[model samples]
Target chain A: MAEHDSGGWTLERTIPSETAIGSELVSGLLAAMQEYAWPAAELFHVQLAYEEAIVNAIRHGNEFAADKTVQVRLSCTADEVRIEIADMGPGFDPDSLPDPRAEDRLEVPGGRGVMLIHELMSEVTYHPPGNRVTMIKRRPPSP
Target chain B: MAGFERLVVVDKEDISVVRFVDRKIIDASEIEQLGAELLSLVDIQQRKRLLLNFEGVEFLSSAALNKLITLHTRVKRAGGTVRICNLHPQIREVFAITRLDRMFEIASSESAGLAMF
Candidate 1:
């Protein structure tokens, strides 16, 4: 974890494939966002997207394997927040995911996490092998 | 009525008006428990109509949305229905982004949600 003179903070951690641990990390990020006075609605968006990404890493990427772990790095500045998450499991092709919004798929319960992450974040990119994902959310314009 | 740790359920006529006890429905275990409790409304208690009130809920994840979808599916299969109301603006935007706003009936007030049934 590192903090810079630019008033930005960065943190990197490798956590066990446990949702509780991920939640703790997220709580810390939320506190940092609050200290920076991130807008309330944007805070909700960050929380939702961050939670979804971490859960995907643990549940789908690692399959909750006891031997596997998830890597998370978060950086925040006055202008934007960036998050990257990677897992120890085999990667998947994001292109292969179905459109959750299809009329026929509306009733389906799963598969919305990836979509939500894409929509909520300002920008999203998936790395090679597909196990690593990076997301960015720019601060909304001041009212 | 059976007890629920995650929800507060009150029967209004034939509809079960349900409100969540947690402000943020993000925890994995808690989400699983919430799913089970909701399913019980149809499976065990035989509730035919449900109105989920999200008055104070400020945050929820895709996992929580999955539970609601599951409950909706079960209710439909049991010849019942589920309606949700009072979602915070951000939470409501989540539904819109996922297009779940098209999948579930959403109302601005409890009375409107109850009226949908």
Candidate 2:
């Protein structure tokens, strides 16, 4: 996809709810971040957020249904990076997710993905039903 | 000694120093395999101490974090211990954000991790 509204580059893909396909999409997004010279720390944040979103889409949202697919749109610019992911499966409420950091839930392995995404991204929002998520990380001002 | 596709395990005294094969541990199947291999050290081989050395890991998702937490749980249940060391700053930030840094015993170097045992 052509860069939208002065973003240096944009990518849009509808990938199957499969791990291998999701990994390729993540690699492409990271490459764009590298090309834009995002700092190493910020790049990790983007990578973590995107990976978690895609995996959540496939595993939790789509339930790995062969018939379902995940829609992904990524835009990278000098000023900020944005990605939107949506799955076709039944959606759930994000607020219902227990805090993985809570003493009672700290040992639970699966609930940390959404927590980490919110922690690392500059901004995160879940649309109605919570099957779709939008995350943005603005570039930090140069020292 | 069992063959390992995702880990390079070295014995240092009573601890097994484990290093990951991939720089970014985000792949699903790989993470599953990694979790299995790590648990094998405690379950099958009966290792009591594990020190995961994160010298080369640059990026990892929460899936990978889940594996580490599982490993920690299994090891502790077996009356063993898990210590992680050499995390790059960004990786360290992930643990901090998840509060896993508090859950895990983190060391600055291999020697320090070994010293914990």
Candidate 3:
């Protein structure tokens, strides 16, 4: 509930894992991030990546558990912005994910979310036990 | 973000181009909004072509890709065509993975997109 900012670094909210809360978290993060002057394209990328991660936590991690919660922590500095999305779901093997681009499996209906996340973020890592996703994006150097 | 700005251009020849003008299509909200806006481009009584310009879009989500398919189906059902152009390398990889590059007419540039009609 307490938000803090220092030297262009700020920490936002911790939200629940219900779909109803997803939009609010996204909007709040976007609003806070806008102050850091992220370019519109990168802003959108962050928004999308965050949404996908939270949705996965809500739908897959919590398995729609009404009592479950997902924590979203955002911090931004002059050089980079970092987001940590943690869920209580049973963690799965990230390596087990099939290649979404496999030539023979082109018609598959799912499995692209993580791929998109990897493409957008400067760094991505998964924490076991709680199934936390950490993503970082660096700001473009000033001209 | 530098070279292009978000530009939705509708030509009199019945083509609508929604240019991303930046690095990616990130969320379902923007994708839905784009679909809605594309629909509004035509009068209900007429059919129109659609071209999603990804010149600046470096990344794309599966949700956005699904929305594109939905848009294509809707426009096709209405007797129009849907084309895609200027896919960034990463985005092109996505389309290839989903095999959507085969589903849609993809061109290298705006002119190529126009020529598809």
Candidate 4:
């Protein structure tokens, strides 16, 4: 819990595309959330959204290039957890992606991450050229 | 049988039952491994029905769902069927939100899921 001072911390790192950093970042973020003292269910939601963000940045955004770098920013505060991951690839129109929820696309295995990100997080906005995403999850009220 | 560290398998009659062993989040390679094991059960062993039991699983990533979709396609081609049961609440919500619930036959219990096949 003493990973940082009582004050919140903000960090930025250019993630190596070769590294699949979702699990690690989520674990670290969960650890970092100790100060906020979120409930288990709320914490799980944050973890899921963070996983999708990091995966999208590394997988689709950077195309898993060893040399390409994915920029990651993590900020933890008492009220919310915010993350931004940007990749160095040609951005695609999010609208062009097929909706996984559509009956025709249900048989297919993709198009879920973005939807999950938006649903799990309190706020999710794509940055133009569409290569970067900012996601936020507000801490649940104390019971 | 011991299925790589994250998965457990039990043969019950004609049903090939697969269970996850822990609460940890499964990554991509592990997902592929699970998919391969399922494919072997359906393809090599000619098992026509699969029951994926998730009572022990604490979380299911999109990667894990992808594995299920892959298995579904493979089994469907062989005239076999894949059914899932005991999905964790969050996982169940994921399947629902993604509308995968509409395509995959999901049941509440292992017996119910197995009966579907």
Candidate 5:
């Protein structure tokens, strides 16, 4: 695991792909994030987004392989916060997923994590080969 | 980056309401802790009603929704009811996308939520 201090308002960490260990690792990273004076709502958004992304990495990206690892890096400034979750799994097309809002699929469960990430964060992008996802949320400027 | 507040209100009738007073964010671990607390309350009581007031929560993620489902299922199986009230437009969109809107009873106001019992 790798973590670094990008001056103030930013912290980053990396972890293995083990699902059980990944969850607790990300949870601790989120707890450290709370030390900053971020708005309570954004804090929750960040935590949830992190969980969804990291869990996906451990489960989908690495295919639950205990040998592989995932990388999570968080960067925050006075104006925004960005988190990049990268995994060793084969990347998939983000466009290929069926729309969760489609009338025919309204009753189906699961498949909302990606959509939720898009709604909560300002940006969500993916890189191929490595199956890495980078999510960003811009905090409103201080009054 | 909106401010967030959460409260657990217990009525004289033994009903417990968990209110999300502001936008729930990534830093709000208290919300999860609150869920565990609510579950414990259900374990101790045979029948109770839980009203989750989302008056100011503008957005919710899958993680948050999972916690809600966890609480709802636990409370319901224990002879309790969980109702959600005052979903912001964005939050409603989340519910619609996840189809959770169908799984839980949603109300526009606290009174409406309390009326579910």
Candidate 6:
């Protein structure tokens, strides 16, 4: 894990595909988000989105194999925070995934994670080979 | 008396209430254990009314939420009712965004949750 705050705030962390590490990583990201003065609601949304992405990378992309690594990057600008997660295993097509909110899909446990991420994040994009997902959260407009 | 690191299950007026102790993330381990415990509430103990109190919980992954869905399904299959209460606002928004709000009976407080059953 690398945390750099000299001129700009950045964090780059790499973890093996171990489910046990999921919470600790989420805590780290959330702590940074708080320190960056993220609004409480937006912070929570980012937290939710990031957790879904990281867990998906660890569980589905890497198949929970300890040999595989999931790389995460957190970078911040004045108005936005961006997160990128990449895993070692072959990835799946997000488009082909079922909608979790669909009446028939409600009972199925598999698709909600991605749905939550897409709903919470402002900009969500998947990279080539579908192994990495990037999410951006722009600060909400002033009330 | 299988104790969970993240949940405290207490009986109240014949209601099985599960309060999450973990303030932050409810990961896969917690979710797996929670799922098994909830299943037993119906499979072994034959509980008919349940309430999951999310008072202290701030952030939970889809894994944990999925487990809750499983618990809801099992309790329903057993002809029991599972109601949730005290969701932190953000978590409540998650339920709304994912449209899980329609699937489970949710209340703003414990008393209201218990009253549902």
- Compose the digit string of candidate 5's lDDT tens values, residues B2-114: 22235545563655666654464333365566555556656654436777788767555565666777777777677777788888766675676577887788888887888
lDDT of 1 by residue, B53-78 (tens): 99999899988998999998999899
User: Where does model 3 exceed 4 Å of error?
Assistant: A2-4, B1-61, B67-82, B85-103, B107-114
Q: Which runs of model 1 end up more than 4 angstroms from their true locations?
A: A2-4
Tell me which of candidates 4 and 6 scores higher on DockQ. 6
DockQ of candidate 6, scored on C-alphas against the true complex (2 decimals): 0.72
Of candidate 6 chain A, the 10-residue stretch with the lowest lDDT total is A1-10
> Would you list the clashing residue pairs of candidate 2?
none
Q: Number of the top candidate by DockQ?
A: 1
Summarize candidate 5's per-residue lDDT along A22-71 as a digit string, tens digits.
55555544554565666766766676677778777877888878788888
What is candidate 3's CAPRI-style docking category based on DockQ?
A: incorrect
Off by over 4 Å in 5: A1-6, A9-12, A26-36, B1-99, B108-111
**DockQ, Cα level, model 2:** 0.82
Q: For model 4, which pairs clash?
A: none
Give the higher-TM-score candidate: 1 or 3: 1
Candidate 2 wrongly placed segments (more than 4 Å): A2-6
Candidate 2, residue A121: Cα displacement in angstroms equals: 0.8
* Model 2 agreement with the true structure over B1-117: per-residue lDDT tens digits: 369999999998777999999998877889999989988888898998889999988888788888889988998898888999999899888889889988898999989988887
Global fold similarity of model 6 (TM-score): 0.92
User: How much is A16 displaced in model 3, in angstroms?
Assistant: 3.1
For residue B71, model 6's alpha carbon misses the true position, in angstroms, by 0.8
The order of the candidates by lDDT, greatest first, is: 1, 2, 6, 4, 3, 5
lDDT of 6 at A9: 61
lDDT of 6 by residue, B1-117 (tens): 355566678999789898877786556776787777767778887988889999988878788788788888888888888889999998898889878899898999998998988
